[model samples]
Target: MLLPLVWMISASLMPLSEVIKVPPVWFAPDKYSLANYMEVWSRVGFSRYFFNSAFVAVTITILQLLTSAMAGFAFARYDFPGRNVIFLIILATMMIPFQVIMIPLFIMMARLKLVNTIWGLIVPSMVTAFGVFLMRQFMMGVPRPLLEAARIDGASEPYIFARIMLPLCKPALAALGIFAFLGSWDNFLWPLIIINSQKLWTLPIAMSRFTEQYIAQTHLQMAGASIMFVPILVVFLA
Candidate 1:
């Protein structure tokens, strides 16, 4: 399991000759350097792709957190007309594949004039069915009596949510944030479909192009892959 990651990191640090060698050298302390990283970062305009990915991913994660938590809280704590039915509908969306909706989603983005823009990648992904479902399931475990006690003290819904509910939901929020960030960071198909401009390309798209341009430079390709891997590792650790 760790071997692939180990190889990626090791290969990223190696020169072209060592990377392409048969029975690949697993350790070459003397040959390893940051030259490939430098080239990828500078020559390949990786900085732009990195920024695009980070910005879009963070934006989506934040929006998903807020939207999911709020919706989940309402579903768990409040009762209204068709509440169960509505919740069921939301859960049903999770069963539908993204491939089934991508075309319509793209058309909607096109109609909104969002295609080829950063918001095009962001707006559609700001909310997710899985996020809502996860938050709702977690929030369901939160004791209702606690909320009722707060209300007895004249706490408003907003106050209870902000001051009490949110605090209690840190674990759920962390889990949701990890999923949202990782999904957005690694997202490829949606970005590929909507974005045509070079400047707007995310790391995944840019990395795809980088591989094509440097198909022979396995070291550089590994460096690009390593760059893509870091944020995911950070999010996991976080």
Candidate 2:
């Protein structure tokens, strides 16, 4: 598992010749260079892709956390009618693959005038069913007596949620945020389908195109993969 990652970073630093040699040039201390990374960054306008990805990922993470935390609190505490059925419906949607609904989602985005725009990549991804489910499960573990005591003291529902519930949900919120950020950052197929303009491409889409445009350039491909992997690795480690 780690070997592939190690090899990718190593090959990314090597020249084209060293990367493609028989048995592979596992290490090339003397020949390592940043030429491939430089070319990838400048030649392909990857800076734009990086910014678009970061913006979309951060926005989605914030929105997902807010929505999930709210929905989870409601599901865990409230006694609204048909709550179980509604929660079931939301969970059921998760079972259906995105591929099954991509066409309809695309048409809806087109109608909303969001296609080929940054929001096209963002709006559809604002809420994730998995996030809601994960948060709901975590919130269920929270004590009911504490919430009741807050209400008995005349604490408003909003205050109790924002001030009390959220403060206690730090671990769940962190996990959900990481999941949302990674999903948004690494997304490719939906962006490829919606973003027609070159300026709207994300890292995954740009990397796909880069692979095709530089098919024979193994060193460049490794360099691009390393660039893409670093963020997820850091977030995962942290």
Candidate 3:
């Protein structure tokens, strides 16, 4: 993994001409330049892809977190008719693979006129079953007496959740945020299926096209790969 990261960065810094050299040059022969990056940026609209990815990832993470946390809270803290059955049904959906429903989901999106739109990508992912499960499990560990005490003190459910339970779930929130962001950032197949327009393409789609456009040009491919992962690598490291 680290090898790829180092090789990509080094190859990207090298001029495109040197990238295809048989000896596989480690860096620019003499003067390393950022021309490859600039070229890749101009060709792929790096900034636009970055913004679209950031928007989708951040929005999905936030919305999923809120929905998951709230749903988890309800499942853990309250008892209602068929609550367990409903929770089990939701968990069962997690067992059903995306492949099983991909075609139907596509048809639904087409019917909704969401195909080729940002919402097409985002709406489907804003509430993941895994996210709900993660939050539910985490919330279950929270003490019931504490919530009861808060209720006895006249705190509303929303107040108790926001002020008390959320503060305690920071680690879970962080983990989910990272997972959700990374998932959205690296997603490829769904976007490929949904979007036909070049202007709305995300980083992964752009990278796929980059490879097709420059097939066997390993250096350019590496540069494109580098462009794709640099931001994510920084985020992971941080």
Candidate 4:
């Protein structure tokens, strides 16, 4: 597995002819150059794509964390009527595949004039059943005594949540944020469907376009793919 990845990187630094030789060149004769990386960055609008993806992913992560944390806190701590039914509904929604709702969601965005906009990409991801479920599960392990003591000392619900619950749930929140960010960052089909403008294209969509336009330039395509994969690789390593 490591060998293939290293070889891909090696080939990406090679010249075009070396990349397309009958027997693929694993490495270049000369020292590695940044020509392929430069071409991908300049000709493919990789910077624009990177910024768009980062912005959308960051937006979704913040919204998901806030919304999911609040909903999870309510579900875990409060005893409102029909609470189980509501949680069950949320869990049921998780079971429904995104494909089932994609068309209707696209149409709704179109009707709302959100299609082809960054809002289209970020809005649908802001609330996630899986995120709520993850947070609720984590919050369930929190002790009732801590919350009760906070209340007895005059801590408001918001105060307790902000001061106590959030601090206690850091690991879970980090895990969820990483998951949400990765999902949004690497997303392709949804962005492709919603983003019509070149400026709004995310990394995956832009990389796909680069591959299509430079079909014969394997080194350049690999360079772009490498750039797209680097952040995820760093996150996983960390």
Candidate 5:
């Protein structure tokens, strides 16, 4: 696992000759250079792709958090007809692969003219089954008496949700946020299928094109791989 990363970073720092050497030489940064990174960053407008991916990923994470939190809270706290069945149906979506629905989803996006747009990337991600399930489990652990006490004190559901539940849900929210953000950041297939313009391309799209355009250029490819890895690492650390 660490070996590939070790090789990538090592290769990113190496010259072309060392990058593709047989048997894969490993050494300290004795003669490493930042030239490959600088070259890649400057050549293909990577900054634009970086921002596109960032915007889409962050938007999806925030929207998913809000929708999941509210829906899960309602499911856990409210009493209603067929609530269990409805929740079960939502969870059932997790069993279905995106591949199964891709064409229909694409047709819907095409009709809405969301194809080739950032919102195209964001809309489908706004809420997810696992997210709802995660939040519900966390919200379930929250004491019901506490909510009832707040109700007795004249607090509304919205107030209780915002002030009491949200604060208590921080750890779970953090966990879900990280997963959601990372998933969006690394998403490739839908973006490739939807985006037609180069200007609208995300990091993964740009990276794929970069690989095709610069085939077998190992050092530059490693640098590109490093570029893709940085934001995820930063988000995880934060």
Candidate 6:
């Protein structure tokens, strides 16, 4: 695995012709150049694609954190009628493949006039049942006595959630945020269907096009792939 990854990075810095030689060239001729990187950036408007990916991923992460934390808090700490049934329904939704609902979701987005926009990508992903489930599991480990003490001090539900639960779940929040961001950042199929404009293309879509347009230029394609991996690598390292 490390060998393949290292070779890919090395290849990305090599000249285009050397990449597909009879035997692969592991390194550039003399010194590595940023020519492939610059070419990909210019040809694909990669900066715009990067911005689009960042916007979608960040928006999804924030919204999922807020909404899932609240929903998780309610499920973990509060009791009401049909609470189990409601949670079961939400969990069931997680089991249903997005592919199963894609058509209906597309129609809903079209009716809302969100198709071809960032909202189309961000809105549907904001509420994730898995996020709620993960957060609720984490929140369950939190001491109820602390919440009771907060309530005794006249702290409301929202205040307790804001002041108490959130701070305690930092690790889990980080884990969930990383998961959500990666999911949104790498999503390609839904974006391809919903987004009609080149300006709205995310990294995955842009990379796909890059490969297709530069099929003979393996070095350039590898550079584009390397750029896509940078954010994910950073998140994992963090």
Predicted model with the maximum TM-score: 1
Error of 4 at 136 (Å): 0.2
Q: Which one is best on lDDT?
A: 1
Cα lDDT tens digits for candidate 4, 43-160: 7679888888889988999999999999999999999999999999999998888899999999999999999999999999998999989999999999999999999999999999
Error of 2 at 40 (Å): 1.2
Please, what is the whole-model Cα lDDT of each candidate in the order they appear?
0.95, 0.92, 0.84, 0.90, 0.93, 0.90
Clashes of each: 0, 0, 0, 0, 0, 0
Candidate 1 per-residue C-alpha lDDT over 43-110 given as tens digits, one digit per residue, 9 for 90 to 100: 88999999999999999999999999999999999999999999999999988999999999999999
| Model 3: per-residue Cα lDDT over 1-238, one tens digit each | 5776777888777776776778877766584777777777776577788777778877888888888889988888889999999999999998898889889999999999999999999989988878888988998899889999999999998999999999999988888888888888899889899998887898899887778878866766776788778767766776
Pairs with steric clashes in candidate 2 = none
Q: Which stretches of candidate 3 lie over 4 Å from their true place?
A: 27-30
Between candidates 1 and 3, the lDDT winner: 1
**What's model 6's lDDT at 31?**
47
| Pairs with backbone N, CA or C atoms under 3 Å apart (clashes), candidate 4 | none
lDDT (Cα, tens digit) per residue for candidate 5, span 1-238: 8999988988888888886667766764876999898889887688889899999999999999999999999999999999999999999999999999989999999999999998999998899999999999899999999999999999998999999999999999999999999999999999988999999999999999999998989889999999999999999999
lDDT of 5: 0.93
The Cα RMSD in angstroms, rounded to one decimal, for candidate 2 relative to the true structure is 1.1
Kindly list the per-residue Cα lDDT of model 2 for residues 1-238, writing each as its tens digit: 7999999999999999888899878998999889888988888688788888889999999999999999999998899999999999999999899999999999999999999999988899888889889989998999999999999999999999999999999999999988999999999899999999988889999999999998999999999999888889988998
lDDT of 2: 0.92
Candidate 1: list runs displaced more than 4 Å.
none
Instruction: Report clash pairs, candidate 5.
Output: none
TM-score of each: 0.98, 0.96, 0.93, 0.95, 0.96, 0.96
Candidate 3 accuracy as TM-score: 0.93
